[model samples]
Target chain A: MMKIFGKVAAIVAGSALVATAAFAEDRKSYPAPKDHPLSEIISGYEFRTPETRALQDDDFENPAYILLDLGAELWSTADGAAGKSCASCHGDAAESMKGIGASFPKWSKERNKAITVEQQINICREEQMQADTWKWTKDPNMLGMTIFVKNQSRGMPIVLDNSPEMETVRKLGEEVYYTRYGQLDMSCANCHEDYYGNYIRADMLSQGQINGFPTYRLKWNGVGSTHRRFKGCMKNIRANPFKPQGEEFTALEAYMMYRAVGLPIETPSVRN
Target chain B: MRFAALVLSGVFMASVASAEEIKKVEIVDGAVQASLTGKPGDAVAGAKVFKGRRAGNCLACHGNKDMSGEQFHGETGPIMDGVADRYSTEQLRAIVVNSKKVFGDHTLMPAFYEVDRLSRVAKKFEGKTVLSAQQVEDVVAYLLTLKE
Candidate 1:
């Protein structure tokens, strides 16, 4: 009787351990907020054509790697009046920048506002390295470096700012996302939220998730930033676009990052 | 030479006047009671405008069962099948001309003939309506053909 009881106890303990492990794994995979509107948070990757998806799967086949290589070079090369490269302060980005990309659009106490990864890079250049800031978007050097840094956090889940300081900015972003603009009289929610899987002409609309930005678009024939894509969308609606480095886009980025929480970073990702 | 100069100025002024004449529309009881062009619309031309990307591009939002041969009908707005059964020609004209005036601000449909009071219109597209008054009439005529 004692031996039978011992065996049953061991079985129960084993099953409980397995259940706990499974729960932890699930949390790690999908750390989405409980109140999120989407029942399932799908990555933009799922919406891409098989060929585009395949390009992202293979590092060599992916055209974004060309830019990433340039970014790697820039990481070690010294520039500006300070005569310092990024490596001078932070050595071996592989170790320091790991998971850095996944955690961005964070609140900056100094700036008194939420800042994106690109903004932070410029800030570091000005304050730390005494260098001139790069253009907000479409600059090849800026694109390469940004993609490189972001690539370090590839496959890591996105982390967003939920602090009290970010509350107003996030609200503003939500408002902008829902507000109708331009001659077309359409909001971001009209297509991205309401009809994500549906086609607007030949193009299939995704949820407009930002986890895969600085994405490699076949249309652009190169890598581009989230803000550039935002500008493109605005133009498509016949609206004059806001600047990439402007406050409106920054707030939008913060809100978008919040929406994309827990999705894996896929910087330099291939898209059509 | 003086006569020729006068004729040239007159011709230029006439062209400008015609360009400015976009046709004033008044909404009465959720419909535009009069024709915009004061002429009958061509349904065939309206169909072409409906399909052309540079023209109405209506298929981008509204699905049409008759246009099944055309790819990628959007679901953002209602399927345009049997749209004629629901609305009259005047009501359709009002909706096509300026949907916001008829359906309020909540509708996603763009005002095809409204050009003023729009925010952040691209420099190139400023003061330009998405569709001409005649085109709107044509689109309305085509829409009227979509019976149950």
Candidate 2:
């Protein structure tokens, strides 16, 4: 009887140690007030000229409408091995996908990781439509779809639902934002946080808030997603960017969503 | 535990290591007299470095009177007209090496050579300067030719 009791006690203690190890890997924490010093900065929208602001306000003048038009058509047209349109499964995106973009970069139980809206779209294409995925960084079709999805959530506040599972990734996103890289030796914070309203030559710098993404940038003269913009910034800093829709970008997206918590979703917005 | 030990060893190596292959420059009487090239700087190579996107990209900020035909010449900094009259060749070399030594540290122009003061530098460039010693001299040689 004494021998059996000793064995049971050892097993219980060993399992407890294993449980603690697993818990350490998923340590839950959000950015404290002291952690992110630039938490109170406003969105980049406030720094734009009146002419640019007017362009974003009117849907007809906005050039992103061209991509939106393409996306609307693609939503109903069948193009995959399944020969089924997105409308066939989801039905009238205006009705089903309204405010959906605001919640994305959400935790996906199937993949066991946080997936961005672009990644979710690709997963749906491969699994349900039996089609090829759009290259999240360069493809026009991908940008159109992303712009269209985000346009649906216009005027809605960004909310990630803040699941406990997403906490680890959200922290990692914050880490990526603050960690400095490149030959220029600049981090996202050095420009966006430390020198928010300063001028680097002719261009005025903003605080780098990403509330109005999927914006039509004058530099590109076309629609661009958040990940696409991230790539451009990496290049500008002379750092080789990671692939779009890759784990690093998804983590960055997760952090961006949390940062823009109170701001309205203004996708397909205009920017210089 | 082994991974942690390896990382610690790498950090230790990084701290004690000095720059190699990159020739060092000297500062004398508020000027940099050390030339990357042992001989006179070639004006031709210097011009290429000034305008090329891969390196100096000086024209992006400072307008050059010599390159008047070029499109989108910036008006941010003083035009490079008669720059030779403004500073001596050695002083110009000093400015390129570490501009903060002459201009205040707050200026937008980057220090082309000094390494220790920089932040968020890439891993491969831990203790290295941006322009090689020869490249800096070449840029200096090119700027010297901007006299009217």
Instruction: Calculate the i-RMS of every candidate, to one decimal place.
Output: 13.8, 18.1
TM-score of chain B taken alone, every candidate:
0.84, 0.78
- Per-residue CA lDDT of candidate 1, range B1-148, in tens? 9999977885564345335556668888668988898888888988877887767899987779988998888655667888888788988898899877876676677888887768888876677677777778889989999999
lDDT, residue A30, model 1: 47
**For model 2 chain A, the run of ten residues with the poorest summed lDDT:** A23-32
Give the C-alpha miss distance for residue B66 in model 2, angstroms.
15
Clashing pairs in 1: none
- Candidate 1, residue B99: Cα displacement in angstroms equals 2.9
lDDT of 1 by residue, A205-228 (tens): 777888888989999988899999
Give the C-alpha miss distance for residue B99 in model 2, angstroms: 8.1
**TM value for model 2:** 0.67
lDDT (tens digit, per residue) of candidate 2 on B70-116: 65554334467877866788888987887656654533456677676
Candidate 2 CAPRI-style tier:
incorrect
Please report the candidate that would top lDDT against the real structure: 1
Query: RMSD of each candidate?
Result: 13.4, 18.1
Each predicted complex: what DockQ?
0.24, 0.09
